[model samples]
Target: MHGLVNRCIEVFLRSTYGNALWQEVAAETDVHPDGFLTWGNSPDGVTRSIVIASARRLDKSAGELLEDVGAWLSRQEQIRRLLRFGGASFEEFVESLRELPGRVKLVIPDLELPGFAVLSDARGRYRIIAESHQSGLMRVMAGMLRGMADDYGSLVIISVARDRIEIDVVLPDYSGRRRFELSPMQVRP
Candidate 1:
């Protein structure tokens, strides 16, 4: 890889997503496409086309990794992090997400929930369908029941569906599923 093309992509990304978001995406995926501002053939046979080829290779494992997840509650935790998020509040959560880069529609039932659960980084929003090779969707139905305490009122998660999770009450929907890490202590931003 030549510094020239790399610089080109850097410029484009800095301008588009802004330094903050672009840098975050770059950190996670390790690809900086800012040079895509122009299409230049590399001196070697390996041109900008190399990026596309590599992406294809990456697609194989990444595709199946998310699909093989079998737990219904895990899926719900995934969705919870995506839709409203599991951090301090729903708003701070969505502000940090990169959108689902592809189109994959998984079935999600709108239902009541018990409490909040944590979501995972993989398969949260990157794939098309949340495929389960085993059984557990019913467990989600039961876990949601756990949120039903006699005297507490708060957003409790009941089940998981991919990056979306169900809570006791409906939250105003945010656009894309953003990944979040939960901590015991709140850090000042």
Candidate 2:
């Protein structure tokens, strides 16, 4: 995993639960308290351990904890800045999500990131297909999308299916007019 992801997790735990809890969790999880190097990489097990330990400590499901982490990540200035590099508007940002792995590669050449695909439904909504070797990451994606909706001041409904995830973004004014038109995008490795 990239150090950026680890750093975000550290920040999320510290901000949401406080430094004391983070210290305790880190100690229990056997994660380093010294912090992750932003440009470096860590074992994937390290992230999994932190997530599992956090879930146990908070008495929450791992998926739920990850959702909160994703929500918190969406609010971080560092994440916002990195995301904003793709676009200025919510629609653009969502559209640009498919290119995230490539973008990450530019910053961390050896890191492996997940893949995304955007498909337009006949009902005028967008379905995002998240492909990853790891399980439960899509739950985090759902929360991140919800947080992004809040960030953009847009109302959105997100649903997850067996193999694909769908997001229906409601435009402003609540009036049944001018639905967003998202161009279909597919970026595969």
Candidate 3:
């Protein structure tokens, strides 16, 4: 896993809990307490262990922590830049999610990022299938999608199927009629 993922977990812990608690979790989980450069990599198991240990310390479910971490990541400037590069609108960005891991590869060629397959099932609804050789990472994808929706000032309801690692994205008014446009594009006749 990329150090960016671990760094985010560390940041989430420090922000949500505290520096001391982060230290405790890192010690208990056997994760390094420092030196997590975003461009570096770590064993996927270590990252997962840190997250699980953090949840136990905070008395929250792993899913809740993952979702909060995803949301917090969206708020980070580095990740915001990447998501902005994906598209200008919530719908467009979500549609381009499948390409994110590929883009991540540009920076870390050997990184094994999670893969996504986004498909439009019907109007206002989409399905995203996320797969990773490592388990439990799909929860992060589900939360990331939710965070992306928040970034666009949009509301989305997400349902996850853990067995298949599929996330169903439902937009209540995704008919494009309520879309917030900055300005109308001009057409030449």
TM-score of each: 0.18, 0.79, 0.79
TM-score of 3: 0.79
**Is 1 or 2 the stronger prediction by TM-score?**
2
**Candidate 2 local lDDT, 13-126, one digit each (tens):** 888888988898889878778667565877888888888898888999888888788778777655655665665556676778888889988977777777767787644378
Is 1 or 3 the stronger prediction by lDDT? Answer: 3
Q: Which lDDT tens digits does candidate 1 get at residues 1-189? A: 344334433443355336765455454545553433434434422323333333343453322222222222223444433443323443233222223211112222222122323334432211112233211222322232222211122333344454443333333232333333554144223
Q: Name the better of 1 and 3 by TM-score.
A: 3
Angstrom error at residue 13, model 2: 0.3
> Model 3, clash count?
0
lDDT of 3 by residue, 69-187 (tens): 87777776556666767877677877787788888789778776767677886755777765544335666766777777766666677776652334344553344422333333421
Q: For each predicted model, how many residue pairs clash, with residues at least 3 apart or on different chains?
A: 24, 0, 0
